[model samples]
Target: MRQMPPENPFDDDKLKEECGVFGVVGVADAANFIALGLHALQHRGQEAGGIVTYDPEAGFNSARRFGYVRDNFTSQKVMETLPGEVGIGHVRYSTAGSKGATAIRDVQPFFGEFSMGGAAIAHNGNITNAEALKRELIDRGSIFQSSSDSECIIHLMARSLQRNIPERMKDALRRVEGAFSVVAMTRTKLIGVRDPRGVRPLVLGKVGEKGYALSSETCALDIIGAEFVREIEPGEMVVISNGVVESFHPFERTASRFCIFEHVYFSRPDSILGGRSVYETRRQIGVELAREAPVDADLVCPVPDSGTPAAIGFSHESGIPYGMGIIRNQYMGRTFIEPSEQIRNMGVRLKLNVNRALIRGKRIILVDDSVVRGTTSQKIKDMLLDAGAAEVHFRIASPPTMWPCFYGVDTPDRDKLLAANMTVDEMCAHLDVDSLQFITLDGLYRAAGVPEGRDANAPKYCDACFSGEYPVVPSDMIAKGFEMKTAAE
Candidate 1:
């Protein structure tokens, strides 16, 4: 029997991207390419991985595992099982699914055999209205095999009267609400779709003369030697068959409200978005943060790994020396064992250790991408103080995350977020820091290449966590007495 990995007691106070999806058509050993792409996207999700392939002889084949892509999809013995020239894959960190005995069943590349032909789908992002849809479908006699929000699409497609898989998929999407970027495969075609708001990302790429690929980020394409063609636009769907590609727009047009956090945290530094380098954008964010909130400190330090690039920019802009005061353990997977009371009190020593020699008797400015729950920040502060640092100040790269995200990111509810209920002064007190400041919302817009600033009437991106302005209405939450906060509020 498969069991879930132990939860880490030393979890960081950061939001997590839910999943990554990839697909390829007209390629030999398509599952191999899908594996490579999923490996590149491993940073997005690491709990579980799956691949589904279609062949004329075998019809459809699927393999799902409860671990990293590199561990599960690398072996020649495993790759040989999925023989096809068309396939789709997914890497998941569960946002919606039962976390019990049936959890592995929820790992996706969900399949459905319609009257026309069978289609397999791998999806990123959450479906807010899934519970309502699931009840309605069950009332109509649809038996769900897994307890996952994504399975609603398969059942919805099974009930569609549309002529083809793409049309059925369109019909299904029209009924669902919230963010989605999907990669799917029918017996004859590979399909990709992004939601109307473009809340999650999907990119198109070309491989040699006869192959095409769809991936959550350009980094996946880079790993497989594929050339990025373009990002799949909001509300756009592409179908690839027999080396030919066709595009369709099924949903009504809306201004693309891409997730701003993609720039602040989610995406890989090597990937490009909207033609801007992600690393450069992050560096600019740090530059903006330094300009907006400078501190009198002897050294600037980063939380390590994710915080490195921004810290470099802060050091450059603030004219402060940058040093590695905190060193992270390289082998620490996000997974952590359940801690006893004594271990829980021990805090960050498991994943990070302070370089006491560099930290002693120095005032330090710490740069991190964002703060979510405040636990990690508090622990880091205590660690720094224990290391004999004279003072510790925090400069965040983004504005206070005052609202919960209902899109692809796995954010805590509003009540759990420290910024949602506290002022900067209150947060500083809570963390027991000398000072705390976040980058202004306008400064973030400037760093994101919109120098004119966020227009109150027509905002360019989804800053829901910062601005409480969600592009897509969260229907399920509304039904549960959750009120949507408009930009004016």
Candidate 2:
């Protein structure tokens, strides 16, 4: 069902950053490699970024700052200040900590100091049982600092047995649920792990003698000139030391149901998830959408960057001419701050301006990957109509989002989702569009290269945001640990 989006209403339907992490070891420039990898995976987050490097002589050196990777991290002094042969980095979008309310503590590469030496860790997902675990730890007298779920893992590691690093990590990992693709750097080793269901993407790569780089997307490897190895198998722990990589499966294996949203929205188009090029797959989503909903559109105009490839495919299959309608003013959008309702609205307007000449008096089919808040979609569609579009037909490449994410996405409460309360016809009328359609779940599965029952384990996807089958249930779905603590303080 589709409900019309309000011009300024809240929506939890938008795709969100799942978080990005990367680590490298035994290289002369591990710090640089990590920074580059983080840049490639920048789409994963923009709220905060950091890198933690390990050196025998100086111990661990960490540099992090809140904001976009280019804006805060890798600044001239930051890059000069960071150095080591082994390190880990993260690009984060805070779901809890209030805007500009976070300190260095909130940023990741949360370091753990214990009897077995220390380790610097970077995480790429949310913890489902965070509140319960934090409460339990608080009862045991664990001092909480930041409201980040990633910090929970650090405290868990600090309390684990001191025998071996891998054993300690595994001990803590087995207790956490939801989605996670973690990378950690001990004084001597780099380690990576994925949840049993593989709800998030993590890949292992080799770059010369340094040999290993672990990242949320394979495109990070391309940024650093590393050769792509296979994915870090779900439910497995990978330890890379002395230019050698080994795997250990301590947790029971589960079905390989990778998060389908990665292909539809989260990942970099150039990146490869589950061994498929994200750019190519998104285009296929468009081709499939065209076959499913053959609309009478004079021209196809993509929503911009992420929507472009699929728009091309829709144009390819539907015989409609593909034209660039929205040109993102990246320079402006990147710097625009959204601390209030008015600013967020003004920011969106300034971010993209419709081409009156192309859209005016034309039957336009606007192809977008997904409609999260529908705020942006409604505004954009209206912008086209204001530019004199004869008629606007909306084509979404994915199913409507009905559930909030427990993994990592900062989905608003369920009630805030546009798809939650409205049907497609209702939504079309609400948005005042000429017509609307969404790709079927079956079509979404096919776009991922999962052909029917052929692969056996094929088509298993996390459509929690669409079907509401949450992979893991967080104890308190509404707990704003990050903000709740602030008010208490």
Candidate 3:
């Protein structure tokens, strides 16, 4: 489980959604299995969740529940409530949602009337060109109920060709900029698409006979007893129908630079990624961290669940004992839900407590994936110091998150990032640590390499969040965001 931020001041080290999408076809109870897959993928998004299932006898049935999957869509009774053999699921993080119209309308599985009947689509990535596309659609008299970028694709599909939904989706997809791993349902076809850069995860799986599952991670496949197959390629679309699956990458293929963050902090340990095990990848990062920056510390401690892999690797490499310094109380549902001001403070305190027996009088090297705002790390350092650690040295397995991620990650605005504004020395001083080391960008790429920088002909990454080099620029670059009130908005 990941630690959340406080109500005000954005004081918590919250990592946003990396976007999770799932699809299933051909299983006996595929609709229910899709729900199970969604439960496994709930970690990807906590804001809005939904499932669109189809029934051969009746029709497409959808059950949408907002909030955590456990609280919103738990119970076999609920699973049985949905009907269908083929289905698609989405857990989302909102970007443009507003109180009046955007939030409600944007809850996905956007359905539209089209030439080839109708289709329901759910998406997990942001489109840099959404504003432009929305403007174009509105100008052409297309009405929109949702403000989500996901809905843009639905409208585009609606205004597209009659031959096939998949082809129409591919045609529309070719025009959109940024990351997307889309799953759509139609009367006769189920479609899946991944953007050219492969910034998000979308993998293929099979349950038994005539059944397949597509998801952002393998954990869902495990839940539904679906065997892991392969990843949907960058610039590719796959369609399922009549016990057959076909793929088309009409757009030119590009290099795959699977988002490095997936292995660093987003994905579950049990999931396999990009030819390597997630746990293995995180552990290897620790091994590399030790080789690059090693220290003679008494104990190697992980931040919590996210840092466990690197801690083990650090311990193995340093020949130092590994100990669970911070014990995370998995039972804490939401840190923000702590009732009162005092309880909120206590809730943060109660979430994790330093293991006194292991840290007392020991020089500790604290290993974590990355630090967003320095507040949480500083507090943890103070906590460890209070627990009697002789000294604290912080080691980050992934490169410092120097930039915000706009594609799907819930990164704060530029000024909020610690690494972007402060020097390494300044950051260490701010966190009040004896020393600190971050994995280099080159090292990150070397560990989880991406395609060569934008070749003139190939599709590229929207590193705007990382490098401030967004693929598509806003028409109103000077305008305020959704958070701004009427005057600014």
Candidate 4:
């Protein structure tokens, strides 16, 4: 099958979040709850979705489809086949496996059978050492079923000598490196585990009385009417069976370094991370951006959905009026077809249009989350100019994205990241904007709840994309000749 094109091909210049994982145990029609939870997390990944449920008589039943959760999982035809009280689901955009034209085999909630029992897993972060593990495993006679790095976990578990599935899972993860938030299921248990650095997110929640859930964000729990309990700590593993919960530390303890971009982007605005509201944090970022890079303009406009909260905060801090100068077409979807060059050339206009009445003769301050390839920024700026805007000033909510992320985000290579190649002045000139400014790394940390600012000696969050200081070494990329920043540099 030819890989389906992105929803808005011309406007897809932002970094893509890898995946979202969700599981529920002790609920009636658990697949239904899983569907709702995955729907809430659809922002994380939109290429494909899968669900696996275990019933005593039916055994393990799974449905993997290449599309949005609503389009595939909402049908009674698919849900009826997956009847069980325990289920786990995943929504994916393919950061680690095949790129375009995803094969049905690559759709996740990957399952494996072992001597102890059968287990299914849904993983939310990238595994940096996947290639090395795959090479070693293949040499040892492990026949792989898919190209996904997440498949390594199941293979490793199969090789473990542990007598039970949970212990074997611990054994499997112990040998792995890099960021991960995994939700897996065995015959009677729902398991959730995070990487040693907690570079990705995973939260635990409770349903009515005896039910429990594990999800990539609090927003998903809300969809299923599950009460937020707490986050699965860095390196901590939890197994829920029959309404009882068991926690274990599967890896050596280390200082936590959660991904900072979760606050800037990636996560849903309504979700909570580390006890702080994601939307509030984004607004705070705008507040900090205004203080760091003030621009005098008639109106403060956002790039659209992702940039709205930050733009509001910017307006509040800068004492400028916020206006909807650009409106997004909410009905456009991934399945939108561009059958000809004429349609393709319409580009960003299909997704966003400038409000000529609001923008005419106005000096606008455009607040956006980040600048990736600079393509979308250029297009949006041109749209504003064509609408008779006198001046366009760009204020970015996050620091320059100068590096690619290996911890589950799908970022362009270093050469393709505009910030990596061009200075702020050069970027401003290239985009033909009157001015362009990004929030300082320290400002971002402050908005993310670090009041004292980032301590270079012990930074609080994983800001590899901005600081080039990765919490976990990306072994596979390094082996492929990717360079790391030195201390002196």
- Top of the candidates by TM-score: 4
Worst 10 residues of 3 by lDDT: 1-10
* Candidate 3: tens digits of C-alpha lDDT, residues 369-445: 88887777887898999999999999998766766665667777657889878988999988889899987654554
TM-score of each: 0.96, 0.92, 0.90, 0.98
What are the lDDT scores of the predictions, listed in order?
0.89, 0.80, 0.74, 0.92
Candidate 2 per-residue lDDT over residues 1-489, each given as its tens digit: 012222222223366674799999888867888889998988888767889998777788988887677666656777766777899999977664434444567788888887878888888878877777888888988998877778888888778875977888999998897788899989889999998988899998888865688999888899899999889988988999998888899888777667888999898898888778889899999998999988997989998777898898899989999998777766663444444767655545666788888888999999998876577788888889989999999999888876677778767666677887788888888888999999888888888887661232343877777765555665556454311112232
1-489, model 4: which lDDT tens digit per residue? 011234557656898888999999999999999999999999999889999999999999999988889999998988999999999999999766665554678888999998878999999888899999999999999998888889999999999999999999999999898889999999899999999999999999999999999999999999888999999999999999999999999899999999999999999999999999999999999999999999879999999899999999999999999999999999878788854789887778989999999999999999999999998999899999999999999999999999999988888888989999999999999999999999999999999999999999999899999999998898999998899988775
lDDT of 2 at 42: 85
Candidate rank order under TM-score: 4, 1, 2, 3
Decoy 2 TM-score against native: 0.92
lDDT of predicted model 1: 0.89
Cα displacement (angstroms), candidate 3, residue 446, comes to 3.5
- Full ranking by lDDT: 4, 1, 2, 3
lDDT of 1 by residue, 1-489 (tens): 011232466764778788999999999999999999999999888879999998888879999998889889999999988999999999987767766566789998999888998899999998988889999999999999988789999999999998999999999999988899999999879999999989899999999899999999999999999999999999999999988999999998989899999998989999998889889888898898899998899999998777878888899998999999999987876545557889878867888999999999999999888999999988888999999999999999889999888787777777888998999999999999999999999999999999998897898899989988777877877787777885466
